[model samples]
Target: MRREIKYSDNYLIKQLPKATAYVNRDLSVAHISDSWLNNFNFSSKNVKKNNILKAFPTLTTKWKQDIDYAFLGFKNTTKTDKYFDSNIDECWLEWTILPWFDEEENVIGSIIQVADVTENFLLKQKLEKLEILIAVKSEIAKIGSWEYNAVNDKLHWSDMTKIIHEVADNFVSTIENALNFYKPGKNQRRITEYLDQSLKNGATWNDKFQIITAKGKEIWVIATGKPLFEDEKFIGIIGTIQDITEDVLAQQKIKESENLLRTLINHLPLNVFVKDLDSKKILVNQSECDYLNLTSEEIIGKNDFDLYDDETAQIIRGEDLKILNTLEPILGKETIITLKDGQKNNFLTSKIPLFNEDNDVVCLMGFSMDITPIKQKEEQLKLLINISAIQNKKLLNFAHIVSHNLRSHTANFSMLLGFLIKEADEEEREKLLEMLIDASDNLLETIDNLNEVLEINTNPVQEKKNIHANTEIGAVLKSLKLLIKNKRTHITNQITEDIYIKGVPTYVNNILTSIISNAIQFGQDISENKIEISANKIKGYTIITIKDNGIGINLEKNKDKIFGMYNTFHELEKTRGVSLYISKHQIEAMNGKFIINSKVGKGTTFKIYFNEND
Candidate 1:
């Protein structure tokens, strides 16, 4: 049989599996278990009977004090500390130090136990870091989280969630009280529905709605919620809320601006259109559609080539291309278009390039206006200017004529009277008296003619009627028949009876009588002097020609003065030099033209042009 061996208390303590050590009152190591040696990387000879603080140089002063407290019979104390082993690897230690009792229950020393808690300590640090990260992110994004407990009828709001609501940190909120933070009507009702759906059907919800903050200010928020479940039973709801007031208001303003612009352009009277880079129509206002005689649906997506002739389309396309390439605007470009109905219209058009954020031409905007009426008015203005210039020249001639004729007649009368008063011979005195009387009659006749010229000048417009040229010419010839006989002049009237002219009757008779009388008077020196009259229609005018073989005028020398008053070509007692001047004025007043062809001895020809009548 084997001998029975007894195990002592020290041997039994050294065999313990935990890292345990027994120390004396002086903190000297009395005994240590096998795990204790392994944990500290020590052997029995190095640690037994050695001071515990000296054997483990890593133990801090606080650990020594706690061991001393255990010697005073205090309850067990536990502490955790960071440690670096011989290899400098990081470790965490949980030390439990308690007093050891003798058989009489008196404390003798302390027993210290240690555990390696490195894994648990690292996990706890990670959890703390993650919580800090979540808090920072929530604050930056203006987002917050909340949870509701149906069992306790309580609501939990995170720190950021309370801040979002503008509530105190110590604020206590329940589910009903939390719902009150939403706006009164629609927001509150919607939130309630969302919660109900989440609770009953375990659904998730996301919505954007309005809310009232604790300060009684309204704001916009985006909210999301998900039902919480445990063992297939609904328990509560968890969700997130974010403040989005600025974003929501900005979107609203953008929409309102778009609507206002649409209303303004649609109601304008000018033609407005927008086109893409390809010259295809994108947008057009009502006025543009009306001008094109097409609806918006028909015009959109179409180019100039689809709506206009090839020539017009090419012109428009060229302009659009220039604007896009140069990024410049063409303003007030005048264009003319001939419509399908053969009517021509004028337009003032403008086109400008539209740019994108990168300062690139993306599209073009155009405006057009009809300017045909303005162009017509300009043409009328030019015609009026020509008429004004002609009237001004006529007035200047009349002024010079009046002043010159009056002065010449008065001087002649003065000299003739002086000769009559000084002559003693009755025959000579009577001759001077007759001469003075003739001068007086000439002056009176001159005054009457001047008065007629004044009337014509002041009233440039005359009432015109159709007069037969042949009958009028016959009447003039008969009135001057005695003079024609005395002058031995032969007059031939070849003006056809069917010919008619538009003129004032008085002006027509005056013109004919002056020309015929002049022919008869000037032909006295020529034997069988002949005058011929003829008429023919040319263009829009009836041209009457009067040819005479008489004392012809030197037109090259007196061309400028031929139609001037008191400018007589021949030295004759009856030549007053007023008839041709008056006749020319009358012709112009009737909107007719007077042209003269003459040579010093070859003869003279007068051509009068009047409007041709039916």
Candidate 2:
């Protein structure tokens, strides 16, 4: 549109508000509005071909910088808009200049528009002052403020707000910047959605969320905001930012403490459970789950009736109800439960009522300890006490026998010696002296036997060491080789070389020697007398067997008394029955055990059991 630009025909431009003008590239005035003439008190001659700096000399270097930037071709288009006072005084006008161009893309002139925004500018300045005041107050109170302008796509956060967010001093605030400050995962998503929703529905919100600072420090902040509205149209939002990091962390610590308490309850070894007052389901620990043989999901919502039979359930429910109703703590109550395996186990339980905020019982918390082992130990102790009483009784009988037998021999010897001292015949005196010598030998033998028993009892118990049964057996056989040769007895060793047993060497050797010697002496009349020793491992225990093709006891007549002291099956001249008794006791003391299997004509098999190496 090639049209002539004229200043005389534009009457409205003369009266138009603000300083309006048209200037050529050379700063020659093409036209001037009456508002500009009035503000600057200028005529056509003064403004025409005038330097822009000369017109606004008070602008200092700012005006010169704008002229240089526009004239040096550094930029094809330029706008220098700033607030300045007019000659009328106290009147601020924002002068905006736009460089104009011709059709051939030549810079010909410029359009200058000036607006009197003094009132709007002052109001904004007041608002900025209020914002700064709020920031100062909030900083002192540990609070900050933010505003989002959706229409302008701008964000404004107070200085204190930026500081609270742990951002740099020069950081430009934006919604993206705010969102980036929040920690990832739930907190970020939640806050982003909350802001979006609040903007959409114009809803007010006050929320706390977690964030990571620029220093990678975790912080908690409380954000409170309301929707921004202009003429009932939603614009964006404005809000306060608070650094509630310390308070939030303290609350988290309390929550963690509560969780830790619950974790402790779950991990307790005892069978722990809690029953809800209104609900039939009971929460139970892992121990309780295993006891019931039910999965956590299976038994979590069911009552006693679902887990047990009617009768059993009633028994439990009644007691639980009593504890709940009475609000009394019941502890260490013994109860018997029949397990799914058809085995009964005893439990020591404690039941207490759990109260709600109103002090009303809302649940029953129960703890049960499996006391089966304790009960078994009590029974074992009672049996051991009886056994100890019997042992004492036997010791008393032993003492009486020793006293009576020794006393009789001593009295007879003393009487005979007294007679011998007065005897006149030498033959009679010699007979009395021989009798005293024999009595002395008997007393010595008795004392020796007593000493052996005492030594066995006084020996300190020690842990069984791994010893080769073959080596010990061989040593025993070697010691008794002379006896074997004299009797022409054959010995057979069939024990596995690698099958060792844990035992004391002395006790094990004594047992082997005693049994083997007995067998050899009893087998004197057998045409082909043989003693066999064998060992094998069974059921985590080592089993050793010694069988002899010698005289066997009539089990029908002497089964119970075969291993008893002084109770001999056959009248073998050296039958003390002490060997078998001592061997049995010794084997048991070492944690190994013994059993004798015999038949009247068939021979006896002595089996020894030793536990395997741990």
Candidate 3:
């Protein structure tokens, strides 16, 4: 295959279609291809005998020297013209200069071929810039490329891979060493399993696992790989690996915080709930669910509309909406719920609007405490207040009666006794003495009433005994026999003899005697002094009803004051309101209740109940 061209090959060179030309050792144009002359805009007949540099004035000085070197038997000497055109800025050209020799191996002339390569050169520049951009992006993303050769069992990693592994640049890598960098337990097993499966089924893998670096730092990473194949035969694998420790750690922390929040709220005793603006329950604690007689699964995601009557639901919704509109807290608001058992329960609750980062009212947070027992106690306290008011008013009235009535009676006694001592006439002295004696007796009566009021107030609890109600009423009637006979009062006792009540025997006797005597004394235009007393067992208590045909009280105006101390609504001088007042206290102290009903000019009825055993 070794050969050389002689001067006779000038015809062959000139016959080529390229922009080719030949020059003698003198550098004069000796031959030119017809295609070459046409391409360069030159006529072969006029260009044939000119020296190479003289024909192309744009040629540099070095061109002639390079042609002379070619003429010294150098073949295929190459060069390029980067700024080949006089009018174009991006013009470029390539030249291949070959030596034409004689049969004796002496240089005869040189052949020159020219081509324009401007387009290809521009394309090469663009490709080099794109590759640099890709490499920079991979480094910034912590992405590293890897490849494995099945035939030679070789593993090759990019520079980025070595950097991620925290190893020296000169570190030599192998399959075994790379696998060792992965965590020794589950991580290593996962990789081996994925690799084997991918090799068997030509499958692709993209998974996250942990790895230990050369510096022994533990980190999370994501590996993505696809099985590599050539000519439909399995060859190796190639893929990318990325460091993703920060992302995984953040996700783990978020999960832990959510779990902690759930645990704390679940353990609280107060009924707590959170609702969105739509009034649907977003979160409910165990206490809230229990208060509603439901489980969290049933209560959450539901609103009042689902759990209550329309009227109740509307009321609750209005409260929630107010909180949302005002973005304020509502505290110590009492709410009543009628339970399924038809018993009403009271709850004291607090509601506050919850806001988002943007300062928008997004939810409502509420706390509720069951306060039914407290409300009951509150009612009891109110009753006690009314009773105390009654007692204080009675005490004030008793003080007034004592001051006015006792002072008047005592002053009369002093004046009457003084007159008796000074009077000389026997009849006048005797009359004044009688007056003094009557005044003294009235003073004693007032003192006794005041003493009884004081005694009743000082001792709230009294000793009691199980006594037959009929026996007590009978004894009271017998003691008042002389007055009843004089007044012609007819008392009818219809009580069962065995009906018993636990009470102070003296109080029971006094209460019965005073009531019966009043009935007889207050009788108005009656054909006979009529009074009826009866007793029976009813509703876990013994009831005693005393009925009479008498001039009854004007209860519409005087019922409130009927038992007030020293009050007298009638013209009857024997009526002192202190008796009924004392009777009420004695009955209450014995755990009994007394009720009275009366009508003006008609009749009166008194009902008393004592606990069955009392």
Q: Identify the leading candidate in terms of lDDT.
A: 1
Clash pairs, model 3 backbone: 501-614, 502-614
lDDT of 1 by residue, 546-568 (tens): 99988799987899998888789
Better of 1 and 2 by lDDT: 1
lDDT (Cα atoms) of all candidates against the true structure: 0.84, 0.76, 0.80
**lDDT value, residue 64 of candidate 1:** 82
lDDT (C-alpha) at residue 253 in model 2: 98
Deviation of model 1 at 589, angstroms: 3.4
Query: What residue runs in model 2 are displaced by over 4 Å at the alpha carbon?
Result: 1-272, 276-346, 350-394, 397-401, 415-423, 611-614
Maximum-TM-score candidate: 3
What's the CA error at residue 511 for candidate 2, in Å? 1.0
- State candidate 1's TM-score: 0.57
TM-score of each: 0.57, 0.46, 0.65
Question: Order of candidates by TM-score, top first?
Answer: 3, 1, 2
Candidate 2 per-residue lDDT, tens place, 1-614, comes to 32355655467667777788866666667777888888667776788768655666555466555544554434433333344454435644566556555566555666667566667777888999998787677877789888888899899988778788778888898888788888999989988888878978877878888888888888888888788788999888889888888787798899999789768977888998888874365777878888888887898889877777667678888887777777888988899876545667889999888887998888888899999999999999999998789568656755765687678778987897899889999999898889888888877876776566556655765667888888888899999998787667898899877978688777788888888887787774755788888878878888878888777878778877765555678766766676776676676567667777777767888887876653
Query: For model 3, what is the C-alpha lDDT against the true structure?
Result: 0.80
